[model samples]
Target: MRRSGQNRFPEVDALRGCAVVMMLLYHMLFDLVFFGNLKMNLFSPFWRGYVLSGASLFVGLAGLSLTLSFSRERKHRNVVPFSKYLKRGLLLLFYGMVITLVTYLALPESYVRFGVLHCIGTSVILAYPFIPRPWLSLLGGLGSIVAGYFLSLKIFPFSFLLFLGLKPPRFSTLDYFPLFPWFGVVLLGIFAGNFLYPGGERGFTLPNIPAFPFRGLAFLGRHSLTIYLFHQPVILGLLFLLGLIRFPL
Candidate 1:
């Protein structure tokens, strides 16, 4: 399975690419409506609920990829480059911090205290020591999600874990993905990574799934961390400039 030097898993990349594309499209629409460039029927409860599933796809795929990247294979280094992985995870957290600062400066009302990207990056670091054990990661991930569900009630006084999914009495944020259940998802990735190997080498180019979607989506997924931070701001800025130029009403 695992050979030597420059290990490449195009299938996982493609999967991630798919996730990223879906996310980008969703965010594009979300950004458009958010900045008032256009209106969406998200005002309806059903529509709002439907859109929420978009996050699930992003998160679930994130988990899957996280595991895939870190799992051990023959001679290709021990279960995902720990040092590099940790470094990458920290970088993601650093970027998340930058976003938090920007949000505080721009939109304190909807600042991202513990958003998905933040959670994913941080969870990756937190998940490092535990990747070797599959069952433990599974239990941890499941427990985290379940715990998050319970904690959302906001009964406990642990404000810190609020980011862990403990809902503050009237809390609200534009982006939020706490440590508990969210970390569980990453752990799910770890578990899946440990167990599954996409049978036969070569990687990616699944015949059943069409090529265009696969290419665009995989591209998005590969650059997800970068895209996640920048997409909204770019969309919002373009909308603003467009509004100023044409629809100055």
Candidate 2:
């Protein structure tokens, strides 16, 4: 997944590839249900675990990538600039907003209010200030995890803070990844990246593996954002052509 002219960590891209594969499988199952080709509860423990684990992997990898990028920039320039991160985060947020509009138009009853893209973008922006302070970032991450856990146990009257993991009464969403616990995961990744990678270079050498199959996976991982943006529509379109685009509505 290393760009031709940029610094990259191959292992990170491979891990991202793994996460994306899992995500694709999960979404395929979801589409099967949407098209009445499956009759299983997606909220079942197996599905829930699968989804959460994949999300965690992706978020953690994102944090790791941030640290690497920051380190590379800092090496060339004495100070790390915030503009690049801000631009990328806002761009992702815009894409998330597009998803929201599309879902609202297509499936208003269960549209995405705040999904993975929103969480990642928001987390990147919010976590930027803490990246330079690994210890503080660790504490913040732990705190968010604990706070979100307890918060999830209680319900609120309003839904405004749903992005923060505050559950509102009778609320439902197609996808939700609140900042509380999930951002904490990102922080933890930052902590790990700082501790392990130190200056963004691996502390230890890794054996060079053949790039035949792994490179193929890395390609998918590198373009994951673009793939995510279009995969659902592609899946649905294929299903529609196969006479499987059934919906209760």
By TM-score, the best candidate is 2
Tell me the TM-score of each prediction against the true structure: 0.79, 0.93
Candidate 1 per-residue lDDT over residues 1-249, each given as its tens digit: 232135545556666666666666766677667655566775488656654565666666566655555543424753456676688788888888898889887778878888877887888778877667779988988898888887766566456766667665657677788887778878887677666643224333345556666656556667777787788777667867877222223
- Residue by residue across 14-58, what tens digits does model 2's lDDT show? 778889889888887789886767888999998889898999999
Tell me the TM-score of model 2.
Answer: 0.93
Candidate 2 Cα RMSD after full superposition onto the native fold (Å): 2.0
Q: Each candidate: what lDDT? A: 0.68, 0.85
Q: Candidate 2: misplaced stretches above 4 Å?
A: 1-5, 208-212, 247-249
Q: Lowest-scoring 10 consecutive residues by lDDT in candidate 1?
A: 197-206
| Model 2 / residue 40 / CA error / Å | 2.1
